[model samples]
Target: MRTAKRPLQSQASEAQKQAALRYILDAWEEALHDGIEPEMLANAALFAALADLIDLYGEDAVAKMTTGLSRRIHHGEFTLRRTAQ
Candidate 1:
Protein backbone atom coordinates (compact mmCIF):
# COMPACT_ATOMS: atom_id res chain seq x y z
CA MET A 1 0.00 0.00 0.00
CA ARG A 2 1.09 3.58 -0.77
CA THR A 3 0.04 6.92 0.62
CA ALA A 4 -1.08 9.68 -1.70
CA LYS A 5 1.22 12.67 -1.73
CA ARG A 6 -0.04 16.17 -1.12
CA PRO A 7 0.16 18.70 -3.92
CA LEU A 8 3.42 20.64 -3.89
CA GLN A 9 1.79 24.01 -3.36
CA SER A 10 -0.31 22.70 -0.46
CA GLN A 11 2.77 21.22 1.15
CA ALA A 12 4.78 24.40 0.63
CA SER A 13 1.99 26.57 1.99
CA GLU A 14 1.69 24.47 5.12
CA ALA A 15 5.45 24.64 5.63
CA GLN A 16 5.43 28.42 5.28
CA LYS A 17 2.54 28.72 7.74
CA GLN A 18 4.37 26.59 10.30
CA ALA A 19 7.52 28.62 9.89
CA ALA A 20 5.68 31.91 10.29
CA LEU A 21 3.95 30.69 13.47
CA ARG A 22 7.26 29.57 14.96
CA TYR A 23 8.80 32.92 14.13
CA ILE A 24 5.88 34.82 15.69
CA LEU A 25 5.99 32.74 18.88
CA ASP A 26 9.74 33.21 19.25
CA ALA A 27 9.46 36.99 18.86
CA TRP A 28 6.47 37.17 21.20
CA GLU A 29 8.31 35.29 23.96
CA GLU A 30 11.18 37.74 23.78
CA ALA A 31 8.89 40.79 23.79
CA LEU A 32 6.90 39.53 26.77
CA HIS A 33 10.06 38.81 28.78
CA ASP A 34 11.15 42.35 27.93
CA GLY A 35 7.86 43.56 29.47
CA ILE A 36 6.03 44.75 26.39
CA GLU A 37 2.44 45.56 27.34
CA PRO A 38 -0.31 43.37 25.86
CA GLU A 39 -2.23 46.35 24.50
CA MET A 40 0.92 47.76 22.92
CA LEU A 41 1.84 44.40 21.48
CA ALA A 42 -1.62 43.94 19.96
CA ASN A 43 -1.52 47.39 18.38
CA ALA A 44 1.85 46.98 16.68
CA ALA A 45 1.72 43.26 16.13
CA LEU A 46 -1.66 43.25 14.36
CA PHE A 47 -0.48 45.60 11.64
CA ALA A 48 2.81 43.82 11.17
CA ALA A 49 1.21 40.40 11.17
CA LEU A 50 -1.58 41.43 8.81
CA ALA A 51 0.89 43.10 6.48
CA ASP A 52 2.89 39.90 6.36
CA LEU A 53 -0.30 37.92 5.75
CA ILE A 54 -1.40 40.24 2.97
CA ASP A 55 2.03 40.01 1.42
CA LEU A 56 1.87 36.24 1.43
CA TYR A 57 -1.83 35.84 0.62
CA GLY A 58 -2.58 38.82 -1.62
CA GLU A 59 -5.09 41.58 -0.95
CA ASP A 60 -8.18 39.80 -2.28
CA ALA A 61 -7.67 36.60 -0.33
CA VAL A 62 -6.89 38.48 2.85
CA ALA A 63 -9.89 40.71 2.34
CA LYS A 64 -12.10 37.65 2.06
CA MET A 65 -10.54 36.26 5.21
CA THR A 66 -11.27 39.52 6.98
CA THR A 67 -14.96 39.20 6.19
CA GLY A 68 -14.94 35.78 7.76
CA LEU A 69 -13.02 37.17 10.69
CA SER A 70 -15.64 39.85 11.19
CA ARG A 71 -18.33 37.19 11.24
CA ARG A 72 -16.44 35.23 13.86
CA ILE A 73 -15.96 38.34 15.96
CA HIS A 74 -19.63 39.11 15.75
CA HIS A 75 -20.46 35.62 16.92
CA GLY A 76 -17.90 35.85 19.70
CA GLU A 77 -19.10 39.23 20.96
CA PHE A 78 -20.76 39.14 24.39
CA THR A 79 -22.99 41.35 26.46
CA LEU A 80 -22.41 42.10 30.14
CA ARG A 81 -25.39 41.79 32.48
CA ARG A 82 -25.97 41.94 36.21
CA THR A 83 -26.76 38.58 37.76
CA ALA A 84 -28.35 37.77 41.09
CA GLN A 85 -26.26 35.68 43.43
Candidate 2:
Protein backbone atom coordinates (compact mmCIF):
# COMPACT_ATOMS: atom_id res chain seq x y z
CA MET A 1 0.00 0.00 0.00
CA ARG A 2 1.15 3.53 -0.72
CA THR A 3 1.42 5.92 2.22
CA ALA A 4 0.43 9.54 1.95
CA LYS A 5 3.22 12.07 1.92
CA ARG A 6 3.17 15.15 4.12
CA PRO A 7 3.65 18.62 2.70
CA LEU A 8 7.16 20.03 3.15
CA GLN A 9 6.23 22.94 5.42
CA SER A 10 4.18 20.71 7.68
CA GLN A 11 7.09 18.35 8.18
CA ALA A 12 9.25 20.57 10.37
CA SER A 13 8.49 22.55 13.50
CA GLU A 14 9.76 26.10 14.02
CA ALA A 15 12.30 24.89 16.53
CA GLN A 16 13.45 22.25 14.10
CA LYS A 17 13.93 24.96 11.50
CA GLN A 18 16.08 27.00 13.85
CA ALA A 19 18.12 23.98 14.79
CA ALA A 20 18.62 23.12 11.16
CA LEU A 21 19.86 26.61 10.43
CA ARG A 22 22.28 26.43 13.31
CA TYR A 23 23.67 23.16 12.06
CA ILE A 24 24.13 24.55 8.55
CA LEU A 25 25.76 27.70 9.87
CA ASP A 26 28.17 25.68 11.96
CA ALA A 27 29.17 23.61 8.94
CA TRP A 28 29.51 26.77 6.87
CA GLU A 29 31.90 28.30 9.39
CA GLU A 30 33.87 25.08 9.57
CA ALA A 31 34.23 25.06 5.80
CA LEU A 32 35.42 28.66 5.87
CA HIS A 33 38.04 27.76 8.46
CA ASP A 34 39.13 24.85 6.26
CA GLY A 35 39.96 27.43 3.56
CA ILE A 36 36.92 27.15 1.32
CA GLU A 37 36.12 30.54 -0.19
CA PRO A 38 32.76 31.97 0.80
CA GLU A 39 31.83 32.47 -2.84
CA MET A 40 32.61 28.84 -3.66
CA LEU A 41 30.66 27.65 -0.64
CA ALA A 42 27.72 29.85 -1.56
CA ASN A 43 27.65 28.60 -5.14
CA ALA A 44 27.78 24.98 -4.00
CA ALA A 45 25.12 25.60 -1.39
CA LEU A 46 22.77 27.21 -3.88
CA PHE A 47 23.30 24.49 -6.44
CA ALA A 48 22.69 21.78 -3.86
CA ALA A 49 19.61 23.52 -2.53
CA LEU A 50 18.09 24.11 -5.95
CA ALA A 51 18.84 20.60 -7.08
CA ASP A 52 17.19 19.07 -4.06
CA LEU A 53 14.20 21.40 -4.32
CA ILE A 54 13.79 20.59 -7.96
CA ASP A 55 13.97 16.90 -7.22
CA LEU A 56 11.27 17.15 -4.56
CA TYR A 57 9.02 19.83 -6.10
CA GLY A 58 9.91 19.85 -9.78
CA GLU A 59 11.60 22.56 -11.80
CA ASP A 60 8.45 24.53 -12.62
CA ALA A 61 7.22 24.68 -9.05
CA VAL A 62 10.65 25.61 -7.73
CA ALA A 63 10.98 28.33 -10.37
CA LYS A 64 7.59 29.74 -9.45
CA MET A 65 8.49 29.69 -5.76
CA THR A 66 11.81 31.40 -6.35
CA THR A 67 10.20 34.16 -8.42
CA GLY A 68 9.11 35.85 -5.20
CA LEU A 69 12.67 35.76 -3.86
CA SER A 70 13.55 38.95 -5.69
CA ARG A 71 10.88 40.89 -3.80
CA ARG A 72 11.73 39.23 -0.51
CA ILE A 73 15.41 39.99 -1.03
CA HIS A 74 14.68 43.59 -1.91
CA HIS A 75 12.73 43.86 1.33
CA GLY A 76 15.78 42.61 3.21
CA GLU A 77 14.16 39.47 4.51
CA PHE A 78 17.56 37.79 4.47
CA THR A 79 19.60 40.65 5.91
CA LEU A 80 21.58 39.53 8.95
CA ARG A 81 23.41 42.81 9.59
CA ARG A 82 22.43 46.41 9.07
CA THR A 83 24.41 49.61 9.28
CA ALA A 84 23.04 52.94 10.50
CA GLN A 85 22.06 55.10 7.61
lDDT top scorer: 2
Query: Model 1: residues >4 Å from true position, as ranges?
Result: 1-11, 54-61, 72-85
Instruction: List TM-score per model, in order.
Output: 0.54, 0.82
Candidate 2 is scored at a TM of: 0.82
Most TM-score-accurate candidate: 2
- Candidate 1: pairs in clash: none
RMSD of 2: 4.4
Candidate 1 minimal-lDDT segment of 10 residues: 1-10
Predicted candidate 2 versus true structure: per-residue lDDT over 26-81, tens digit per residue: 99999999999999999999999988877776676677778999999999998867
Q: For residues 1-83, what per-residue lDDT tens digits would candidate 1 score against the true structure?
A: 22222221233577897897788778877999999986888789889867766666666666656777666766754322446
